[model samples]
Target: MDELVLDGNAAAGALAEIYGDDMTTVLAECASCGRVDPIGGLVAFVHAPGIVLRCTACATVMIRIVQTPSRTRIDVRAKRIPPPPETAR
Candidate 1:
């Protein structure tokens, strides 16, 4: 069976709305493994609740985005990588 996953670029639209920039090209230095790569290279898991982006090399969660009726929450692990803006909601 095919896997239900996509590359990090899949979340570009949502991220663009949050960052006000093209995040796909942003490099992220993984806190777990110290691998640096474009955010677009991470693995993306999209679900009803939110979106989760994980490292391709170490599989560590890079970011999590959850949107509610009244608010949007973005949790990021990599220090150099910026999280979605609060105004994204």
Candidate 2:
């Protein structure tokens, strides 16, 4: 499992091409475990035909991306989490 898994940064190129922005800093909330983390912190499996991003806490599939000759398909199960409130000094 360790050999097959990779950090979410591996998908940064593909994600940037699709979203036209750097997605690594984006925060996502796992639907299954309610764990929030940046997209770069998720577990990534890119050896398959498509890229699969899973939650680090519960191993839940958060995002999947596949590219075809005609178009690119992406399924995102994780929703964005708002940044935490800033504290006053």
Candidate 3:
């Protein structure tokens, strides 16, 4: 999965919207009631409350936003890492 550059505010929605990809699929969960929710990005989502960011698959609750005003600064880019493969194996 390729890391994407997203605006801090839209990071959750961006991930939830593109759930089909391998990278973002890491954000989903199933409830006892058999309902789906996307549970992801709890820490960063606090910039704004009432915003829903869930897992990409089971739709589990991940982020609980509380307080945030306009002009809040957040770094929303995923760090790039090289995977160890062929040679390492």
Candidate 4:
């Protein structure tokens, strides 16, 4: 089967739905390559199993989200999850 792909920005809505807030603006560092970038800048792929967000710099898997009938699992261990961006007053 063909693989589908897009930048991480496209997953904003889905991530927000799961986290109850906007997450696209958050920065994350690739654990493997140590290249930091916004979560919105990573590469993303959506498939039958779930969503996969990868580091654009090194192509390392940064985040994987799987949603089942009863629960959602997000694996960010391979990523350095950043705090939410500062709000503008």
Clashes of each: 0, 0, 18, 0
Tens digits of per-residue lDDT for model 1 on 1-89?
13878888988987876787899989888899998878888889985479998888888888888877886667888657875566653
Rank by lDDT, descending? 2, 1, 4, 3
Show where candidate 1 strays beyond 4 Å. Answer: 83-89
Q: Write the per-residue lDDT of candidate 4 for residues 24-48, one digit (tens) a residue.
A: 8788888888888888888898854
Ranking by TM-score: 2, 1, 4, 3
Say which prediction, candidate 1 or candidate 4, comes out ahead on TM-score. 1
lDDT (Cα, 0-100) at 10 in candidate 1:
86
Q: Which stretches of candidate 2 lie over 4 Å from their true place?
A: 81-89
> After superposing candidate 4, which stretches have Cα over 4 Å from the reference?
1-3, 82-89
Flag clash pairs in model 1.
none
Error of 2 at 70 (Å): 2.2
Residue range 22-54, candidate 3, lDDT tens digits: 323242233322333322322233334444443
TM-score of 1: 0.84
The 10-residue segment of model 3 with minimum total lDDT is: 75-84
- Candidate 1 whole-model C-alpha lDDT, 0 to 1: 0.80
RMSD in Å for candidate 1, one decimal? 2.3
- Tens-digit lDDT string for candidate 2 (1-89): 67989989998887776776788989999999999989998999999999999999999999888877876667788988332223200
Clashes of 4: 0
> Candidates' TM-scores?
0.84, 0.85, 0.25, 0.78
